[model samples]
Target chain A: MKYRRSGRLVDMTNYFLSHPHQQIPLTYFSEAYKSAKSSISEDLAIIKEVFEVRNVGTLETAAGASGGVTFIPRVDIYATGNLIDQLCERLEDPERLLPGGYIYMMDVIGDPLLTQDLGRIFASRFRSAKVDAVMTMATKGIPLAYAVAAHLNVPVSIVRHEHRITEGSIVSINYVSGSKKRIQTMSLARRSLKPNSNVLIIDDFMKAGGTIRGMMDLVQEFQSNVAGVGVLTESIHEEEKLVNEYVSLTKLTEMNVKSREIKVERGNLFDDVYQI
Target chain B: MKYRRSGRLVDMTNYFLSHPHQQIPLTYFSEAYKSAKSSISEDLAIIKEVFEVRNVGTLETAAGASGGVTFIPRVDIYATGNLIDQLCERLEDPERLLPGGYIYMMDVIGDPLLTQDLGRIFASRFRSAKVDAVMTMATKGIPLAYAVAAHLNVPVSIVRHEHRITEGSIVSINYVSGSKKRIQTMSLARRSLKPNSNVLIIDDFMKAGGTIRGMMDLVQEFQSNVAGVGVLTESIHEEEKLVNEYVSLTKLTEMNVKSREIKVERGNLFDDVYQI
Candidate 1:
């Protein structure tokens, strides 16, 4: 391997950070640098030191027939914002129209790469927010919660629609979903959450903030404080109470599935990033 | 920022490969290295080159105040198996005991970091194996599927119960669950899966391999091939067909919740890693 006269650790860390938590074969790296294994191992030691000293990133090495190093979430503000902006642009695309003024952003949510990135970005943001535990309802919310919890190294409590045979006992909360007149119940286990938890709420979609508000009530029942709120897509409507501050990948205003017309708005997270 | 000696691009790529998909704040890296922003920028450029050339990893940077950097899953084989070894150890813990022979690995299965690692590790193992999509049953399997799908960069399709609520229309398959005398049906959308799709089967638990076999039959109905099968936990049975190669985090031979005693046979993935 040609050792460049100038070998920069910061550049290396930045590259590692940007490519956070990606797994590649050792042979791949070996082939790329054409460097002896010993030299590469030494460089990783330095990189690991850099990450540990800062306490903002991690470098893990796994050796064997199926082993290689992998990075974990420890990104700073600059990188987090840049990713949110890219997401907003995708959300802003006019082609995202669906029925009932709802934008069909399933493509974005369904894309594991995008979801993984957004999950890591938000996880970093929430990490500094001092949340006790991250919470999300079933299905879609699981991935987002998983992402955040992974970054923060916290447990994710998933709320199910009707208690499953899995969760022995549950604490249920009944409330109106959005503006709907019907009452719906959402539940968590007493064993799962502690009293007075500092919780960060995350979900795939938020409209009329009812489900989110219900979650807030669920938080209150446990005497927990809503530390913050974050959503993949925030539906546009005035007067969403109980949200102190929020971050969203996309905003849906008016959707006419019949007419095939949908109005979408982007969030400030992206704009804030590009300005930097 | 300090202007110090920089590391080689291959060094950074190797470091990142072992530590795939992490997001760390820019300030953290900047302060750790005491390096100029420009130098760090140059380092990222070189790192990006190795990633592009390799086609096995991705680097995404978020700009602005709220921005940071993250690495997405792009790990190769050597790294993946090592992770599985760690996972199997965690799964083998005595604390994971549950009713019957079931191991309550749902916590790890539900966990983001563990799940992500599991996905990367498994993806690496099956990287060269042809597979169109990752498949799993509803409920618990969703998370596992997402994990594998994230690493493989493939779509995860869900198989539902006999009833059709989550899945409006489905292609059906009938099979026995473990020792159950009665046969049960598993369903997947006829349109959801592409014809002749190569499928990687994953599940939370496999008692008899019947459910997985049912999934195999479902794939056959769609004229698809079983690329491989993966289970979070596989219970030992006297008579379970074992024709195909499979992967499991833990092997459960016996358990008695009342006695609070359990037996766990660890997978061989661990020893292989340590020996190397």
Candidate 2:
């Protein structure tokens, strides 16, 4: 149904916000709203201005019949820093420390508001060139990967540590846990991913890159390329990293299991993105 | 920091859209946007008009101290039916049929856009009452529960089949798996939920409500209350169910593994809500 400019603005904003990274033909909007192509273009121009000035995202427009608009979600550097600082504060809480030096991350990963920003920050830095799907291990990694996939408008493939009856004809692989140095097996459904697809891997936490490397190996099993790897937090506790190419939002500087005092620093997000 | 009416309108709309079910004081907006409280109120009025007329949700304003605006997301009956039909079509795909009477639900659960709407529909039905948090089991139920928690602006507590060291101290319970009619165990982190908190339970699929019932039993172990139960799909193959009170989005009427044929019907969603 055609709507007034004000109403159209609300509708358009919601549509773009919900559908990121996917190109939508202008004709689709024109026909659906019963408006002229020129009018739709004009509407987009105003929406674009608000989006940019507000740092909401970048609205890329194509010029021909096949041309359309795509929303590339982004968060400003200033906002990114502020968000990371808040997250670090939360991570530093002494109560978050478990008996064996594990930080309880479920509370943070379980919140949609925080994960939404974390996902956008990661997506903003990844293979913006082409990412067919987002990959992560089951349970903990699901939320972060799902959030990134949502923004990228791609599917998420979750590799399971345990086999379930629902996932038919699975591909299983064993990899060494870089931390404990123990071998573990991970499985993915055969049909979950397409061969030759580009996948971005994300996780809630990374200590020695054990699980991340495992995911990379699994991606290879599917004949998919690991476009990039992003972690919410990377432990500096591992001096020699098993994986070299990765971007983290926060780095654990110290965690005195004795005193329950913790220290977290801003990660390599800015250094990897805005810096050379 | 200040913006004109159009600019402020855009910002406020996005803010409300993202922070659903949370109250935002007008003064906070006034201070941030450098607009008068009256101006912020006026902008919110316009947003409320669009939101209500479009059936996006209701914008409620409280009157005095602790007074603010809250976005109560709701999907109109027509839109709800359309969403359910689309979901039914997807669920009815012959390819989704798995061996041993299970439906491959990963693809549908992994889509953020579809999941966002599903979450909203579930939230609309439950927001009439007070809900402290959302609860679901590990693995398949994680994404669905997370989406619902996002809409409800509550934390999601995941119950795991086995206790993970990362979860720290946990409370484990055993219950009968209604489909298999075998006893199984589930556990939740001790600190995940507060005592006497009201919780909403959501899952990806249900046949005999074994898992749902297990979750309910787990909630009681925490001294919490089961506010409601929602499932994406419920199989009709079971002659009897272990749990009675619940809402499901789609009903799987037939699943012929031999011929790869599947049939799905409109679930108890509308029948349970509007009909009553």
Candidate 3:
């Protein structure tokens, strides 16, 4: 179908956004819109400028027969900081404090827009980690991991508490459930990851980091390397730490079950040598 | 930061893609880009044309001081069919079959790019659903639910098998676990959704449709409506389906455990009044 120039731009923009990290030849758009190659190039030029100025991403164009444009996503430091601050304020609500010094954050986990921002923050922090894929324990972390993988254009590998027939051959590992302090089993499909691949670990919350450690061990079992670790929120109140070299978007400093009070601060994401 | 015309177009496009269904005033773009309102309007015109031609979505622009732009996501029927066909091919892999006629589909569920397509397909089918939220059972279905929610620009509600301290007060429901024919429990946080909501339910796979029915029942408990039900794939071999008024992207027609073969076909999505 033939399209007007205005419609073409909108469609092309969405296409680039959804297919980030992909190289699409100019001719593809030209033929799709039934436009000249020159017009497509001009459209891409505008997109490239807007993306760079807004920190939405970078657009790299190759010239010649195989010439194409690739969109690379980036996060604005100002926007990232604003998102973190808003999340901190949201978490500090008294009602979010549960009995036994725990905080209820499932609402945030179930929010797609919030998860999208959190994922972008993680992806930005680990942009140089060369992460081939994202791995996470099942349940709350799946959305976050999927978000990060979406931004990074990678697959998400989920480790389940139990095995299911749909996963085919599996690799199971025994790990200490951080909060419970009990040995629990985590399993991943044998075909989920290739040996020697670089994996990034993501989780919604980290208490003692035992679970993260277990995941690292599981990665080793796959002959994969843990290139980086990211947690949406980490409890800094723990007197001991079992994991390191990880980044977080927020920190839970204190939670009083009886008083229904909670203290939340920015996570280690801001401490890095990141551009603001 | 002030930007050039091209820069503004790219940034504007990204903004619209990320914040669909929400309106942003033309002045906002003009001020950010340091461009005239007319220039901004012209840019939007180009975007509108591209979006409509590609069927990426619809771009609605309102005039007057309070008027702005809104991005409404859409799915091209041709693209949707191609995606379903590709997924069907992937699902038919001999390795995806297991004993007892169960099909292993974790790889497809775990893929973010493909899930994005699946989500768009769901979003397109239910565009008129007025979906207030997307709901799904925990584990494999969370990603699909989250993706659908992303397209709809809404929050996702995850029903879980077990309770976590971080979820606060929850409403628990009992239902048959579908394929297993055993009684199982599902729970959701009370505040995850508001009353009288129009919820779109998404699942990774369906067998007897018992779980979907259970979810519809649960929605009633919250005084909410089941706007629609969508499954990534459904099993056609099931002797009976306990649920109706649902759409699926693909169907598992047959699974041969002995021969290690699987037959997959287009699902209920195409059965609807969809345009090609």
Candidate 4:
């Protein structure tokens, strides 16, 4: 079926938005729409211009026989700042402060739109990194991990605290808890990741970075490399962090259980180190 | 800034794809594009036509005051059949069989694209239902639930087996496991859901509907109602199912531990009961 220029632009925009980071051959679109290659290229240029002007993302096109277009999702600094400000406001609610200074963040993390926005922010920050798969702990970080993986067009490798029978062969490691200093165990399925793959570690919260450090160790066990580390929120602590380098979206500077006060600020994402 | 028709088509299409089920007033687009309402309407007409023709989704328009356009994503029957067939074929692999007859589905569920597709299937199936939130068990069901929630533009409420400190005043319930006949506890944070909410339950696998039932009970404990239940796969067993009305995308007819054989077929999705 032949699609008009308007229809082609609409369809191709949807395609690029859905299939980010995927290289699509021009022939695929030409045949799908039964349009000329030049027409398709023209449609892509219009879409790319709109995407950039709207701060949606950018389109990278290759120009040879094997050349195609790849849509890389990104959020501009202004938009990201607004999202982080909203997030910090939500995190500052005194009701979210628990008895032990832990914030009840399930509701925030459970929000699909919010998580997707956070995912785009992280994906943009790690756009230059080589991420083969996203890694996170079982319960809390699962949603954020999947969100990032979706934008990156990669699979998620979940690290569970306990070894389940359904995982088959597994690799387990013991690491001390950052907050309590208690020994903890983390494991991953042997088949979940491949050797020599670059992994991006994402988590909901980071304090002393014990969990992130454990994931780093597990990646090493599989002969893989840690491409980058990202956290939704990190608590400011007097104790030294186990992991030296990572990106955090929000920072919890103070949490007073007795006074029911919680303070949150923007993370290191806009820091000089990131330079985004 | 003013946008041409071509640029409006691309921008509007991207917006609709990202913000599914969201009602956007025509004025919003008209003001953003600096185009007249008639021109915006024409652009939407082209988008709607292309969307339906390509099976991308449908654009629902409401006229008069408080009227707007809502994008409801739907996968055609042909596309859904192909996706299900690919899922069944992947599940039938002998390598996915574990020692205790459990299928190693981590890779399949961990995949962002596959889970997103499955989420779309469930979202389309439950599109007519009033779903306030997508509910799922912790660990495995998180991704599927988030996928569905993303399509429906709703939040996800996760129930966990173990209560963590961060949950804060959770509602717990104990139910007998359908497969092992063992009693287990499930809990949800009190603030995770609101009263009188219509919850849609989602899970990766269902053996005898025990865990899903537990989630339903928890929802009830919070003064909420179960809007619907959906499982990625259901195991056919000699024992009767504990719950009757639910949707399953795939059915596991047989699994032989000794022979290392597995047989998977389409679930009740296309049955007379579903009529989809």
Candidate 5:
């Protein structure tokens, strides 16, 4: 019985190392180990020590009858920002990505762990920022917005492409998504934003900054405040129309789709996080 | 200093209740209170009792210099699963969505506490699976995948849409993403996956199950084994071509796009988690 429990503990620790910032119940682990709750507790104590020795994360236990354990990823800024630079380099391949004038990055956006790590890194940076909520436009922006919001322990308010059934009453605005010739609708629920909220805006990619500007307008309608802005990737050549103390993890510039050429540079946000 | 530290302890315990399952360094809370480290230690003992009486979560202190206090989110499975159902309901709105037949749920995925709670709950369900790693396609799947992976403490394998510089030399495969009309290419790093790995496949949505199938194919290429599959939203009308043991938090179906109508039914995965 002890041998079985110890084996389960090894498996449990391996699982905890992969996920760095979420909690799990003791009963669940006990069941997984096919051992008694007391046995699982002993195993976790040892596993927690392993985490402490590594300096990578912590095995946080919620006590009493109901509580469980959680792991928080503890990558310092230097290690994490490098990962983002790598992501930017991959997306910069123009020959591989461009179908028309638009960049094809659906695949990168679809990647789960990469996005999660990116969000955790952002959360560490914004950990000191007193923001009320995270805001973003529809589709691709939703993922990155969610990542930042998760790290900050804030709610996320997503503006929509078109009005849907979930929004009871709506406030709508039109913004130039690609060019001045094309106007796209951006809508948010009337109740989505609290009055005088300190809002953090996030986006998956930025080209013209029109969608972000429109999102900024939507924030103004609620009489809310802008705390900060973050972009996963931004085009380097295009001049940013409005500068609001924004940060981008990666810079994307000079892409050749046919030649499969791409160049990426790191950002200042990561250094700031590491120093803190 | 002693009096001030004791007062700080009272406040910190109260703060810890609302912000359960969170870790803060000793220096952080101590600096906030402007008290000495030893004084803070005494205060933590008093606070720990309060947590004991309240039965919320545990106040654990790692003794080493790097160790601080962490709170575990320890509610039973019923409350945990119920919250997920509530989120699914929030996502069920047909009107608040877009023309592409997608619900904008980036908001929920980004909330750190909620994501952590959901991750813990889901991880509890698969605690027995001995999963070597968590795998996802990209972007939307990243958040939830990270959550579960965080609790399990496992490395997350990202399957990309195309091979890029960061992934190094890669193995490429072609699969029909949708409707079996267009063959899309997806790539995985040759060295990323350890052979015979027990992988858990996770995604944000499962429509036709093609993406899941493609991911399965990628897992097989590495000679890895799939332990299970999990998705946040499973389209009800979509036929399952491959999966029988998969779990979903919600079922979305009966869509009337014209009337902005839809339905969301909670999945049985929560029941399994709570049963223990």
Candidate 6:
């Protein structure tokens, strides 16, 4: 069957978007479309042009018998800035202030579009990092972890506080809650991570980084390495943080429970130059 | 600057894929690309043809002043069947069998690609339903819920067993665990769902449908309606199910803890005719 250029372009674009970070040989498309290799190359040229021009992502091509093209998903600096600013505005709502200075953010975390945009930002930041899996604590961080995992084309490994019978064998760790100073336990299934794999830890919110520290420790238990850390929001009011190196999208600057006042600022995502 | 047909096609395809279920006016593309409406119409014709032939989605055109095109994502029957068969094969592994006949499904649920496929299947099934939000219990059900919510362009509302101060005002419900006959508590934030909203419930697995029943009751507590229910796997060995109406992808027919044997089959997803 002979496929037209228009059809191939549409199909190829969809293929690249869905299979981000995957390298596809030109011969694969050539055989599937029953077209010449030259024709497939021209089609990829058009796709690469559009992807770059629109800031959709980057298409890196390799020239060799064992080479192909890879689609690296990225969110451009302008889009990332706009998204973070919007998140800051949303987080500044006084109604989100709880009684104990805790900000209610389930709605923010639950917004699929928002989380997807945030995920793309994180994916762009860590596009060059080797991530075998995206890890997060259960309950709240699952969505953000899955969001980043989807963009990076990796599986998500969830850490849970309470052990479940269906998890088979688990590796449990006890850590101090950074702010409350209360001891908490976090566990991961034994089969969740492979040894020596590079895992990216993600969460919705962080204060003193206790949960993220616990996750980092859990990753070490699996003999895995922490490739990078990304958080949706982090509290700057904490006297000290347990974990130091991480990327956060938004920062909680202030929260007054008595006055029901809350303040938010853009996180340190763009403090350093990043290349995709 | 005027854009070429190739660029317009690539941009339009990406837009439709990203903004599923959203109606885009022909003039919107025409204006963005600096092309005539006739040219934009031709582009849409090509996109619609490719989308249908590829089973990517359906592009419905409305003929009126408010007329435009809406992209409804779909997976063809062959692809759906192949995915389900793969899932069944994966589930039949004896190593997944845990104590008390429970199958360890963290890997399956943690799989981003698998959950996205299952989410697409559920989204296709519930394409025509009026789903205001996708609801599910936290921990296991979150990934599936986010997957469906992303495809449906809706937000997700997570239900949790324990309440946190970060959730603000919450509504709690007590229900009997269908298999264990023990009362359990589930809570949802008051802001999660609006009154009279239609919520689509999704989960990873179901034995007696107790968790789903609890979710349904929780939805009622907020004065909302259950738009639909979807489960990745359901246990057919159960004597009775608490919920009757649900679409399941795979069925666990038998399990033997002593023998470490398990049996799985395709669920009733294809038993009924569906229209995209």
lDDT of 5 by residue, A90-205 (tens): 76665444443345554565444466567766665665567898888755676667666765557888787776553456789887764444788888877777889999988876
Off by more than 4 A, model 6: none
DockQ of each: 0.18, 0.63, 0.63, 0.86, 0.09, 0.84
lDDT of 5 by residue, B9-89 (tens): 334543553343346788886677777878777766655644443323356777677777865433455565678678867
Q: How accurately is candidate 2 docked according to DockQ? A: 0.63
Q: Give the alpha carbon lDDT tens digit for every residue of B146-220 in model 6.
A: 989989999999998998788889999998888788999999999988899899999988889899999999999
Worst 10 residues of 4 chain A by lDDT: A267-276
TM-score of chain A of each: 0.67, 0.96, 0.91, 0.98, 0.70, 0.97
When 2 and 5 are scored with lDDT, the better candidate is 2
Considering summed lDDT, which 10 consecutive residues are worst modelled in model 2 chain A? A267-276
Which whole-number lDDT from 0 to 100 does residue B266 have in model 6? 92
**After best superposition, candidate 3 residue A143: deviation in angstroms?**
1.0
Off by over 4 Å in 3: A1-12, A23-45, A60-69, B1-5, B30-39, B61-68
Candidate 2 vs 4: which has more lDDT: 4
**Which sequence of candidate numbers ranks them by lDDT, best first?**
4, 6, 2, 3, 5, 1
What does candidate 2's lDDT look like per residue over B1-276, in tens digits? 768776677777888888999999999899988989988877888788888878788899998999999999887888889889988998888877778899888888877778888888888888775888899988888887877888788888889898888877899999999888899999999988889989999998899899999999999999999999999899975468988999888899888888888889888888855631
The weakest ten consecutive residues by lDDT in model 6 chain B span B267-276
Residue-by-residue lDDT tens digits, candidate 3, A80-192: 88888989999999988776567778789988987987887777677667889899998989999998898888889999888877677899999986767899888899999
Residue A188 local lDDT, model 6:
90
Docking quality (DockQ) of candidate 6: 0.84
The regions of model 2 sitting more than 4 angstroms off are: A36-39, A273-276, B36-39, B273-276
Go through the candidates in order and give each one's C-alpha lDDT. 0.65, 0.85, 0.83, 0.91, 0.66, 0.88
**DockQ, structure candidate 5:** 0.09
lDDT of 4 at A258: 85
Once fitted onto the true fold, the runs of candidate 1 whose alpha carbons sit more than 4 angstroms away are A1-106, A189-197, A221-223, A236-245, A268-276, B1-96, B161-176, B179-196, B221-223, B238-245, B268-276
C-alpha RMSD for every candidate: 10.2, 2.0, 2.7, 1.2, 12.5, 1.2
Which 10 successive residues of model 2 chain B have the least lDDT summed?
B267-276
